[model samples]
Target: MTDPDGPSGTATAVPEPPEKAAGTRGRRRALRHPLARFLLRRVLIAVLLAWGITVVTFVLTNLVPGDPATANLGQRALGDPAIVAQWRQDHGLDKPLPQQYLIHLGGMLQGDLGVSQQSHRPVSQDLAETVPATLELAGAAIVVSLILGVAFGVVAALRRDRLPDHVLRVLSLIGISVPTFWLALVAFYVFFYRLQITPGSGRIDPGLQAPPPVTGLATVDSALAGQWDVFASAVGHLLTPALVLALYTIGLLTRFTRSAVLEVLGQDYVRAARAKGLPGRVILFRYVLRSALVPIITVAGLAFGSLLSGTVLVEAIFAWPGVGQYAYKSATTLDLPAVMGVGLVVGGVYLVINLIVDVLYGVIDPRVRLQ
Candidate 1:
């Protein structure tokens, strides 16, 4: 740069080195990558949230009336002070609350979820064995819900005030209103007892040998192991419970999807597309549905996350050996470590699903990325 008006002197400006400029540009690019920054922020927040959950769960579980040591000892050892004291000491339950929490947190960080007082096995191991069953059930339910819900929603939106729309609305209301436990029982009685169409409560037929456990998801593990008979049996067993779980979610998604699609259909671009003599199906799907998907996706993700944690009743009714069932058992027995483990796992699952949904939002709508 030259300052011509100052002392009649000419000044030369030196350019920054190319490597330095390149490095700055690289840093900027890294910072600008939408998902990288978004994921980093989300992960940091998740870490803090997870720690908070652990602390709260620990405190609350400890505050329950019955002691873990007493619960572990059962009625036989309840009057025996020496045995109960020894059990507390052995399980570190006799320590101060703060000390116990610190110990628990440290062990959690090291992937040790503590041994279940009832099972005498690691809580982590129990979760590993059970979580996949819940995942399988939830995953199946959500898939069914999405497919049926979106389809019904689109049809309802297109029909608007027609008979089909009215019928779907009524059906959705019933679906939402019906209690899951009742539905599971009714389905079991009708299909399994009377009609003998669907298999009874279990992950597989009793007589048939189960496929070797690979993923803990019977249907998946069976298929992966090339056990066709096991796969069929598992699918039959999974359908009723998964469908029962799906019904409520289906209602929610259907209502939300219909509303979103209707809103999108009323938008200027969608109207313009229709006015341009585009094929009705093309305009409906390409313009209307695509525009409507953000809210639908958001609801779906949340519903799926909720399903993952809220399957206790369904799992119990169906006798599905999932985390929800394990959680129920743990809670009932006042199994502190097992309950805490389930809480942490469920919270983590919800956080992860939300994170994925947020990333998907940016992908689906670039404006979200900028925001």
Candidate 2:
């Protein structure tokens, strides 16, 4: 296209309206902001992953070899065809798989996770009741893992080839090798049974009533309510199981951090910092740790996801009323709705953790945002 010629024979172009120019500039600014682009990209990916999770959860649950009506209604109800048919119809099990999936997905979109066949209650409701406990336990475990793992890992790296490094390596290996269930049993037996140092099973003392269900986390709720006795009991009950759940992750992070720190330590910048007479602590923290954060964050996020999902054995051992125990019960009774809800929650947890890790990456290194 050619520009129109003015009366003076000079080429002339029409100017954009002020509003249009302002809008264009705004769009350009948004596009130019690396953080905005990075976040938008990640958010879009998260949405796609979440959609895929719903599909996979629905398909896998439906594929299990059991009749929902039969499983929910029990053997006595099996004799009555009318009752069975009603149950199946009520739960949408009587429909075609595609139709059933559509109905299930629609309900999920509306925050309705369907009724749990085993509990005869909405799976969302059941999850609300149980998920907080699991979150509490997982949160504690991850915190413990991060602190001890990073500390021990950094120490081991600094003292590489020394006795402390060798000992920590051995301990981490043992932690990684030991079975969760076995470790839980031994911890329970030693602390609660033999030594009586920790409370056995349950979230709080059997005698004291649970605090008001504000957050579903006993310690937090009790403390919020100024019920220190309840809070203490909650902590007492929490420590053993949290420690048990943390062991493997702690070991995993220890090894990962050690490797990352070692790699960072060997970098030229680190050597340059040392040669410039920088304090050891400053070099380690400002230079070494900052450079190594990307990998550590990645592993920590994954470890947190594992802690959330793999609490089944620990929850059972501790008799903790969390998603893990709920999942075990749902699976045992073939409660497809409940199982799907659990699966979706687990998938969401991982996605959120990953997103947080990605955001941290951008914050720790500006290059990540550009990518």
User: Across residues 24-44, which tens digit of lDDT does each residue of candidate 2 receive?
Assistant: 667667767889888888889
lDDT of 1 by residue, 273-343 (tens): 97899998899878888778899989998898767655898898888989999999998888888999998
Against the reference, the lDDT scores of all candidates come to 0.86, 0.89
Local error of candidate 1 at residue 152 (angstroms):
0.6
Which regions of candidate 1 deviate over 4 angstroms? 1-31
Worst 10 residues of 2 by lDDT: 1-10
Reference-based lDDT, residue 50, model 2: 97
Show model 2 residue runs off by greater than 4 Å: 1-31
Best by TM-score: 2
